[model samples]
Target: MLFDTHVHLNARQFFEDRDAVIQRAFDAGVSYMVVVGFDRETIPLAIEIAEQNETIYAAVGWHPVDAVDMTAEDLDWVEELAAHPKVVAIGEMGLDYHWDKSPKAIQKEVFRKQIRLAKKVNMPITIHNREATSDIIEILQQEDAKEVGGIMHCYNDAVDYVQACLDMNFYISLGGPVTFKNATMPKEVAASVPLDRLLVETDAPFLAPHPNRGKRNEPAYVKLVAEKIAELREMAFEEISEITTENAFTLFGIKRS
Candidate 1:
């Protein structure tokens, strides 16, 4: 069985055949999925999906890119949303300098506020760091994020950064990029990260693995990621699947059926 630790099923791209796509994932052995919401608009949709599907869970937060326009009321709304029964984590939050959608200062402030909310609610956070490793690490340290440990979704950082997150008790989640021919860094992190600290995800409808690259990704495609990790760490496919699934469950506090 597989547990996709991070996904965005609420995205508009899946509106056409979301039900069918979710069914496909289950049929393909994807036992559970943690659907992440990046903004206020997506949070309710995520909760709605989770409430309808037994295997779907929700993670809510404002993405760094979306933090530019967020106000005090937006933060208050997120705190209220975090109380949802199906909301498993407070995230898809962190720094993303690649797009520069929001100023660095605003992004950091938003990230810190969410961290505090996670602490208040006693829930883990799903982090999204991109091209802003130092700032991300600095803010996480400043906020003392270890209290509510979480996963670094779609991790694409250097060994040092991966180790830093590990030190802070964050799970390192590998996505489709691990299967890319030139993805040397993520491959190294995958091989080096302790089995207990590792998790796998598709980040679906995006980051499709090799052979499936350039195509729309889906939860079922997470098998390709497991296959790649198996090859990288020289482990059996079942072992990789089992360990990562357990790691994901441990992090999200979800029980496997």
Candidate 2:
């Protein structure tokens, strides 16, 4: 069994066959999946998907890009929703300097707020750092995020930072980028990061692995990611699946049959 720890099931690309896509995921051995809500519209939809599917779960929060528009009431609302049985974590939220859609100050404020929210709720967080590793690390340290450590979703950063992220008690997750033939950093991270702390995700409707690159990704293709990691580590495919699934359960406090 495998756990696709991150996916955007609320995206429109899966609109035509969302249920079919989910069935394919289960058939492909994805025993559990975390459907992440990155913005306003997708948040409710993510929870809705989780509500209807036994294997699916929801992680809700405002993306950094939408930080400026997010409100205190919104944070309160998210905290309230966090109590839902299907809600696992409090993010897909972190700094995104790449797009610069929101001011750095607002992004930091929102990120810190969500982190604190997760702490208050005693839930782990799913971080989304894009070209903001330094600040992200600094903030995690400053905020003392180790209280309820979470995942570094789709991690693609300097190898040295892996230790730092782990030090802060976070697991490193690799998505479709790990399966990219030419993706050097992800490959290196996969080979070096502790197997016990590693996780796999497709970030579905986004970064599909090698052969399906540039096409819509889904949880079903997460096997490709597991296979690639197994190859990189020279370990058995099933071993990687079991370890990563355990890592997902540990981080999210989930129990699966």
Candidate 3:
């Protein structure tokens, strides 16, 4: 069985056939999935989806891109939502300089606030860093993020950054980008991250793996990611499946039956 550690099933892209897509994931050997919300609007949707499906779980937090419009009330709502039983972590939150959707200062403030909330709630975090590695790391360190632990989702940093996260007890999650021929950094991280600290995700509705590149991604395609990790680490498919699934369980505190 496989655990898709990071996915966005609540996104509008899956609105039409969300049920069918989830069923397909189950049929394809995906035993569990964590649906992450990037903004206030999607947080409840993620909780609702998780409530409806036993195999699904939720992660509630604001994304860096949405930080610009966030108000104090919005932060309160996020904190309340993080208390939900199905919510396993605080995030899909961090820094993103790739898009100018939000001001950098606001993004940094929101990221730091969410990290503090995660610590307050005693929940792990799911981080997203894009071209803002240095700032992200600095804030994470300043906020003392290691207390709760977390996963670096869709990791795109160098070995040093990866090591910093590991030192902080965060799992390194590799997604479709790791399979891209031109993705040298992800490939290197995939090869070097200890098996126990490694996790795999599809980041569905985005970053589809090599063969399925440029297409809409889903949890069903996570197997392709596992295969890529298996290839990179020179391990068997079964081994990759076992170790990564276990890593997901450990990070999310989900017990496999």
Candidate 4:
């Protein structure tokens, strides 16, 4: 069984055939998934989806891209949702410098708040990093995010930064980018990150794996990401799947039965 550690099944892209897409993921041997919800609309939907699906879980937070829009009430709401039985983590929150929708200062402040929230709730957080890797790392360190170890979701950064994330008790998650032809960094990260500290995701409805590169991504395609990682690490596909699934369970505090 495979665990897709990050997926946006809550996104509108799956609105029409969400259930069907979930079934396909199961059929593809993806036994577990975490639907990350970054804003108001997707947050509630994430919890709702998790409530309906036994093997699926949810993460709630404000997206860095929309940092300016997240109010104190929104933060309060996310904290309340964190108490939900199906809610396993506190973020998809971090810096996204690629977009100017929210200024860097606001994004950092928002990211810091979410990290503090995660630490308070004693739950892990998932990071959404773009070109703002350095700032994200600095804030994570400043916030002492290591107290509540989390995931660097779909980590596409260089190998040099991998050690810092690991030092902060963060797991490096490889996604569809690792399988892309011209993507060298993710490939390097895939090969170098420790197996136990490794995870895989699709970030679905986005970043579909190679061969399906330009199409809509889904949890079903996580197997392709796993397959590529296995190839990169020179390990058996089943081994990589099992280890990563176990790693995810450990990180998310999921007591697998």
Best by TM-score: 4
Q: Model 3, 99-147: lDDT tens per residue?
A: 9999999999999888998998899999999998888878888899999
Q: Residue 86 of candidate 4: its Cα lDDT?
A: 94
Q: After superposition, how far is residue 233 of candidate 4 from its true place, in Å?
A: 1.1
Q: Write the per-residue lDDT of candidate 4 for residues 40-121, one digit (tens) a residue.
A: 8899999999999999999999999999999999999999999999999998899998899999889999999999999999
Give the alpha carbon lDDT tens digit for every residue of 1-257 in model 2. Answer: 99999999899898899999999999999989999997778999999999999878999998998899899888998999899999999998999998867999999999999999999999999999998999999999999999999999999987999999999899999999998878999999999999889999999999999899999999999999999999999999999999999999888888876
Task: Report RMSD (Å) for each prediction in the order shown.
Answer: 1.0, 0.8, 1.0, 0.6
Q: Please, what is the TM-score per model?
A: 0.97, 0.98, 0.98, 0.99
lDDT for 151 (candidate 2): 94
Q: Give candidate 1's error at residue 48 in angstroms.
A: 0.7
- Return the lDDT, model 3, position 138: 83
Q: List residue ranges in candidate 1 displaced over 4 A.
A: none
Q: Candidate 3, 119: how far from true, in Å? A: 0.5
Winner of 1 and 2 under lDDT: 2
* Candidate achieving higher TM-score, 1 or 2: 2
Q: Give per-residue lDDT, candidate 4, residue 191.
A: 91
